[model samples]
Target: MAAGCFYVSCLALGSLGSICLLFTAYWMHAWRGGFAWDKTLHMFNWHPVLMVAGMVVLYGAASLVYRLPQSWVGPKMPWKVLHAALHLAAFILTVLGLFAVFQYHNQQKIANLYSLHSWLGITTVFLFACQWCLGFSVFLLPWASEWLRALLKPFHVFFGASILSLAMASVISGINEKLIFSLKNSTHQYSTLPSEAVFANCTGMLVVVFGLAVLYILLASPWKRPELGILTDRQPLLHDKE
Candidate 1:
């Protein structure tokens, strides 16, 4: 029963995250005029799309790898490698997303890093990069002391969850910022609830819900990965009898 519930939660998270990504992409392309990297307005569109895909969706999924029921009984090395690879991919895409926004801002002669969203984004990305490096060194390297890994594991998990929270905040703030900027002077103002504004609001809500679901999965004790050697071919996971 516990494993079944875990699978259901994972499915819910996957579906929500996918919808968030799709809604973000559609908002950018259909309403924001599509994406390009040619220093035009189109370039700004990539900022939201890539950030949602990389930081929120992929990062959330990567964080759950160890918790997968299949991972509980097997060697953990493969799961560790996969976790690191997913994080690396997320980092690359996040960097690209930052470039898209920064490039567009520079081309338009707008000051950078002046908004709450920008501040949260830059801080989250920097800390996320540091977190990944420290995790790789302490968790993945062969020479790392067992004591060191044990000491850092809690901090690693804490910071990972914290950074994800920051990402969610940044994305929601960015959505608000974009809507205000886009509709402040238009016939269909944000206050009037234009279709674009409504859709964007829905997208932001999706992101928030997705983030909460990921956090729930991360924190649920019954779903956590069992300790090394705790599970074997003949043994069952915690709560398995339920």
Candidate 2:
């Protein structure tokens, strides 16, 4: 029950973060006075941080099931280590990135940082995809050879860590951007862009939706059933004994 509640909370936070990002993007669009791709990209600056946090919490809750002795399922070895590492990395990156974004001040140096941050964020997302795929595959194919399973384990763990580091960079860069924007418009009393708040809200809501979708998929997966014999010609152990 605690795990379930944690999972739900994670989903809620993720959703909220997404909504904030969407809102930020909308504000950028309205302020810029044009539907520019560059502006849209800038708006996406907030996503990596929120995503990292959401993933961290989501995985953390799932780990609880594995940790409990009575409820534990599947072989536990390097997988547990890898899982823990990924979660830790995710948390670190998410927190760092959020800090960086909140502290951002737009300047030439900051701009360069933003560029580097964007690349890192993109890389992190890619790694995250790989990790998720590998994890799901392992869950489904528990009977597979240890060697093959082990090969994918490192990829998941290492990539997850890399993603976290990158997410931290991305957040810092985003904050710098915000700071720069503020400095540049010091003389302005109010934003010229109409509906800036509305846009930000919209973007944030979208992010929430995306996070919820991810959580739903993870929770809905049939991890309890082993895939090997479910669809094969293998008979029950009792029949084989006979």
Candidate 3:
């Protein structure tokens, strides 16, 4: 029950964070002028960061369901390591891509950076999908030799971690850009325009809430179990019925 609740909480928080981020981006674009589909799409250039982050929290939570004590089946050591690595990489690439998108304040820079960000972001997503598929297969049907599984784990974990870390940095960069914009335009007040800072603040709050929820689930879940040597080993205990 605790495990289920933890997974659900993480998923809920992740979904809310994604929604808030998207809505805030749309609102900012709308406030600037009438909506252009292209411009709106461009505004969502940083969306991959939120998407990857949400996925990480979600997948991480799901992992607990299968890996925790008392579960029907837990991932073998090799598979577990791979899973962790892939998630981390996804997070890093998404963050870096987002940063690249926000670094451009001018049209020319935006144009230039868009390609770079898109390619890197797409690559990250592809890698994540591959890793996820591999994980699912391994979990569902354990066919690989222990040695082979062990060999693959570290490579997978390292790349995934790299991606996620970079993706987070990208998110920070985007927020920074917004802050700079606010500072520059604070003196001029439009008749009906909402400040960019407001949108950024709301987004930040959502991220914080979601992050806390994820952390709570991680810490609350039962990852350890009491040691029982006989129970730990694969053996059936017989009950005496007279």
Residue 147 local lDDT, model 3: 70
Task: Estimate TM-scores for all models.
Answer: 0.95, 0.39, 0.49
The lDDT of each candidate is: 0.90, 0.46, 0.48
lDDT of 1 by residue, 9-82 (tens): 88988999999999999998888899777988899899999999999999999999987877876578888999
How does residue 36 of candidate 3 score in lDDT? Answer: 29
For 70-149, candidate 3 gives per-residue lDDT tens digits of 33334245545554565555456445545544553333344533544445545656666676666555533569776775
Considering summed lDDT, which 10 consecutive residues are worst modelled in model 3?
A: 233-242
Per TM-score, the best of the predicted structures is 1
Q: Per-residue lDDT for 1-242 in model 2, tens only?
A: 43454346556655655454555444545554323223243423544334434443334343333323223335554555565565556545554444444344232134433466567655665566566656656744467677877677556545544544444444445444443454455554225432443443345345445444444433443322223334223212212322
TM-score of 3: 0.49
lDDT, candidate 3, at 230 = 24
For model 2, give the 10-residue run with minimal summed lDDT. Answer: 233-242
Ranking by TM-score: 1, 3, 2
Highest lDDT model number: 1
Candidate 1 vs candidate 3, lDDT winner: 1
- Report the Cα lDDT for candidate 2: 0.46
